[model samples]
Target: MTVPVVYSACEAYPTVRFVIATQPVASSLFVNPPQNLTVVGVDVKQRYKGTHGIWRLMGDLRREYAIDAFIDLHDVIRTHIMGVYCRMHGIPMSRIDKGRSEKRELTRETGKNLHPLISTRQRYFDAFKRMGFDFGETFTSVYPTGADTTLFADITKPKSGGERWIAIAPFAKHEGKIYPPGLMSLVVDTLSQRAGTRLFLFGGGGYERDILEEWACEHPHNVTSLAGKRYGFAKELALLSHCDVMLSMDSANMHLASLVELPVVSVWGATHPYCGFTGWHQNPANEVQTDLPCRPCSVFGNKPCQRGDYACLRGIDYHAIVQRLDNVINQR
Candidate 1:
């Protein structure tokens, strides 16, 4: 999500060097970045372990790059600690305004303010603007021509002109955001029956891999599972760039597909797009969600359903999702 904003910043200020520090796992997403942008992976778990490690990281950044200013996209305790280091050094800094109060009211159990809020992407852009930088939206597909996927020959074959490729990322970090497995399987079965349509399942973790593999086995001819393949972000994004459309929850995969300018048919439950996490330039017509007063109970979909039934997700018709995907893919 932040990837696009950073890309725009780099493009807007070509003469200024922009170094992006992010998690090691996410560094690969910065494929074909602008020459002015340098992405560095910080291994917070291993190299930057705790408070002391964060302090060391600050020292290293100043010593190595002579950073002119610090911007905190993620305003957690770790980032705050880094801010402290910048303050001590008399370096200018800014942090993203997350609109926590607005988010809380939007997700309150009752009397929810359901209007759309500033998007996370916009927040990132605003953070840069506060630091006296200006830019318009300058991001497009990460793969301008097409991604080179020659290394993935075993899992993927050459794309045929008649084939319609669809990528499905069925898992989310939270149960509230996930569709029911049985119903999702129904959707899979229905789509598998379509002519000239191939499905690729994307996910991670042992349990998710098992489920994806099972679906692939069930639809042996049309479906392929890429879960647990350990392809990493760069290769996965390459594969996704070739896909006509992606079906995913409001998870990292949705954002990943968006980075490649692939349209996503996103499903929402406990999380609402009004909370401003929608994929960049995705059509709202493709969002499959149920309308309920108790909706958007959590910002990240991490909270358990207060109604205990999760009617927001359960009430959604699987056929609606299938219809939306067909509309997007066939129109393309």
Candidate 2:
């Protein structure tokens, strides 16, 4: 008989259906797939707010799906509540220890010489194996569907209109994660001097959007700030998809650009790709980051650098990045 499993997290559930749970967890679980699955999403924010209600929802879902097993990709207190509820109902469940992964990354960032461990992608698979699912391959996958595409308009903008374009994503969830604005401007100015090249900014509305506008005003005709403009993630993806290349700090846009298969020049500050959250869908050969002693200051880049200098990002050689960009764009 086919095993009945319910997979749930906050996002990305359609792809990973087996033993699914609600949002965040759902989203993380959807990154991997297993046979005989039913996916569910619990739309909880990253921060804890509606956690008390999660158990009630999970209880309802369990009865509805006759959920045999619960796979908690999100191991928060809320998930713990669900685990307790599942036990009360005599339903077997397993949880992926994301906190341990975070701790491992933190240890590595703090100059601790931990033995080289499995990739983040592999760790997810290993989590499943603990619950009796055996899978191989450690790389994360991103498959954009029609629903994801519907976020953008169908019109293709011309890239050859006497302008060499470089896409810039300046905003990330954390402030320290961004490359310093002065440095960003310097890179844009240096690159704009190349014939037919211009800078196209991509991001949502906020303080960073204001910064992009200020940069655009300073550069006038060369820099176009589209940060707060009318464009969905799909449109942004489509636009970045056509650009010769992209320059981004560590953020969701980095992942989005990767999905479009864009050659990205990533700036690493508080976080590092070795933590396993690097380009999920892009070519590994194209990622550019600094190898600093104080690099990878955090797992999610939520904290400021302990040292005031932020040398990991501030110390990056602009010339080297430009050279790498030349190689990537020329080959494309």
- Candidate 2 per-residue C-alpha lDDT over 43-142 given as tens digits, one digit per residue, 9 for 90 to 100: 6653324756766677678668767777665577787888888899888877765556555555454655433344554555556667666644332223
Model 1 bad stretches (over 4 Å) = none
Whole-model lDDT values for every prediction: 0.90, 0.64
Query: If scored against the real structure, what TM-score would every candidate get?
Result: 0.98, 0.73
| Model 1 Cα lDDT, one tens digit per residue, 84-172 | 99999999999999999999999999898889999998999899999999898888878878887684566788778899999999889
Where's the lowest-lDDT run of ten residues in candidate 1?
A: 146-155
* Shift of residue 124 alpha carbon in model 1, Å: 0.4
Residue 197 in model 1: shift from native, Å?
0.9
Model 2 regions lying over 4 Å from their true place: 1-51, 99-111, 114-117, 131-165, 196-198, 218-222, 281-285
